[model samples]
Target: MKVVIAIDSFKGSVTSLEGSAAIAAGIRSVYPDAEIISLPVADGGEGTVEALVTASGGRFVSLEVTGPLGQPVAAAYGLLGDGRTAVIEVAAVCGLPLVPEAARNPLHTTTFGVGEMIAGAMRQGVRDFIIGLGGSSTNDAGTGMLQALGYRFLDKDGQDVGRGGAALLDIHSIDAAGALTGLQACRFRIACDVDNPLYGPEGAASIFAPQKGADEEAVRLLDRGLRQWATAAADLTGSDIASVPGAGAAGGLGAAFVGLLGGTLESGIGVALEMIELDRHLEGAQLVITGEGKLDGQTSRGKVPYGVAQLARKRDIPVIALAGSVDHGAEALNDHGITAYFPIVNGPMSLEDAMDPAGTRYRLQATASQLLRLLRAAGRL
Candidate 1:
C-alpha cells in the first residue's frame, strides 16, 4: 500500500515532522512492507518558516533586527531549495510571544524587523517571497517596515516620524525617494487568512488590538491613527489599502505589501501547499493521512488538514484525519473530502497527560495500527 502522511503540528505536544513520524510508525507496525511517505506541513503561520524550509531542504539565515519595541532581536528567514524563493514569517521578528503580557502594546510596537528580514533575504539574491502574516505584536500600519526599506514617513515639519501605530496620526507625507530600488524586481506572495480592513469597526485595531495588549482607549487611538495612515498611503500609492481585504493583517503589514509592493494575499494553506508541491506527492497514493492539534468546524477554514484533503480528493484518494480531540462540529469535515476522522486519545486522561510527547507517540502508533487492522478485516487493505 502507498500512503502519504502530511500531518500538522499537534501544538505544544508534537511538531508536524514528529506527528508524521508517529503515524508512520503505527503504519509500519501493522504493514511493515507498506510504502509510507511522510511530509511535514503547516498553514503558513507559527511553524511556517520551519516547515517550508525543512520540507524543501532549505536552510535558515538568522540575523539581528529591530524588534517590535525597537530593541535588537535575533530573527531568521528561510531560503527554499529553489534558491530563489525566500520564506519569511513576520511573527519571527516581532510576534506577540516576544512581548510579555505586561508589555504588549500595539500602539508602541513596530514591524521594522519585518522589513529588515525581507531586506536580508534580498541581499542573498532571493527575489521570490512568501511572507507569513500572523501572530504580530504591532499595529503600526507597516510604517516601521517601510522605514527600514528606505520609505520615509515625514511629519508636517518634514521630520521622520517615530515608531508605533499612534505615531501615524501626525500629518504625514510618505517619501519613497530613498526606498529600496531592488524591491521593484521582487514578487511577494503573502500568507494571510484573515480579511479585516485597515480601519473601522471591523478593522485591525478594533478587532485585534485588544489581544495585542491594547485597551479600549488604545484601540480607538490606534484605529484613528490607522485611518490617518490609510489616507496618506492612498494619496501616495493611489490605492485605498485601508479598505482592502486582509490589509489589516499583521497590523497593516498586509496593506504595505499590497498597496506599495504589489503583493498578492492568498490563503495561508494554499500558499504552503503550493510551496511544498503537495499535489506532486499525492500521485498514485492509496490513502492520505493528515491531522492537527484539534479538528473542528474551523478546520474547514483553510487549515492544513483541510488543504491536504482537498488536494487528495482531486486525485480520488481516500483521506483519514487524526486529531488530539475531535470536536462536535468536526464531523462536518466529512463533506470536505476527509473519508474518516479519529482522535489520538485512547481513553480517559488529563489534557496535560495526553499531550506528553512520549505518550502521544505511543497512542498515535497504536491508533494507526488498529486502523489498519480494521481496514484489513473489512477487506479494504
Candidate 2:
C-alpha cells in the first residue's frame, strides 16, 4: 500500500516535517511494508519559508534588515535547492508581532525590510522569487519597500518623501532611474489570498490597517495616503493597480509587486502545492493524510488540508485530516474533499499542555495508529 502524508505545522507545537514523521511512524507500525511519502506543507503564511525550504532540501539565509519601525531586526528567507528560486515571507520582518501593542501604528510602520530581503537574495544570484504576502504591520502601499529597491518617491519639490505610510501623502512623482539594474531580469510569483483593493472602503488600508495598529482617525489618514500613492503609482506604471484584486495585501505590498514589479498574484495554497510538486507524488497513492493546527470553516479557503484533499479527490484517493483541534464549522470540510477528520487530542487538556511539542507528537502517533487500525478492521487497508 502507498500513503502520502502532507501535514502543516501545528503552530507552536510541531513543524510540518516533524508532524509528518510522527504520523508516518504510526502507519509504519500498522503496515511495516507500506510505502510512505512525506511532504511539508503551508498556506503562504508564517511557516511558508520553512515548509517550502525544508521540503525542497533548501537552505535558509539570515540577515539583519530594517524593521517596520526603522529599527534593525534579524530575518531570514529561503533559497530553494534548485539554486535559482528564493522564498520570502513579508511577516518575517515587518509582521505585527514584532511591534508592541502600544507602539502599533500603521502610519509609522514600513516594509523596507522586505525589500532588503529581496535584495539580499538577488545578490546571491537568485532571480526566481516566491514572496508570501501575509501578516504585515504596515499600510504604506509598499512605498517603503519601493524606496529600498531604488524607486524614489519624490515630494512636489522633487525631494525624497522618506519612508512610512504618512510619507505617501507627500509623494508627487516616482523616479525609477536609480532602480537596481538586474531587477528587470527577476521574476516574482506572489503568494496572496486576499482580494482587497489598494484604497477605499473595501481596500487595504480600510480593511487591514486597523489590525496593524491604526485607530479610526489613523485608518482614515492611511486610506487617504494609499489613495494618493495609488494615483502616483498609476501615473508612473501606467496601470490602474488600485482596483486590482489583492492589490492591498500585506499593506499594498501586493501593489508594489504586481503593479510595479510585474509579479503575478496567485492563491497561496495553490502556489505551495505547485512548488512542492504534490501532483507528481500523488500518482498511484492509495491514501492521503493532511491537516493543520486547526480545522474550521476557514479550512476550505485555500488552506493546506483543503488543497491536498482537492487533489486527492481528483485521483479518487481517500483523504484523512488530523488536526490539532476541530471546531464546529469543520464538519463542512466533508463537502470540500476531506473523507474524514479527527482531532489529535485524546482527552481534555489545557491549551498550553496540548501545544507541547512532545505531547502533540505522541498524540499524532496514537491517533494515526488507531485510524489505521480501524481501516484494517474494515478491510480497507
Q: Report, for every candidate in turn, its global Cα lDDT versus the true structure.
A: 0.91, 0.92
The number of clashing residue pairs in model 1 is 0
Runs off by more than 4 Å, candidate 1: none
Backbone clash pairs in model 2 (N, Cα, C under 3 Å; residues 3+ apart or in different chains), count: 0
lDDT measured at residue 74 in model 2 versus the true structure, 0 to 100: 97
Task: In model 1, state the lDDT of residue 242.
Answer: 85
For model 1, what is the C-alpha lDDT against the true structure?
A: 0.91
| Reference-based lDDT, residue 335, model 2 | 95
**RMSD (Å) of each candidate, 1 decimal:** 1.0, 1.0
TM-score of each: 0.98, 0.98
Worst window of 10 by summed lDDT in candidate 1: 165-174
Give the per-residue lDDT digits (tens) of candidate 1, residues 118-156: 888889998999999999999998899989999999888
Report the number of clashing residue pairs per model.
0, 0
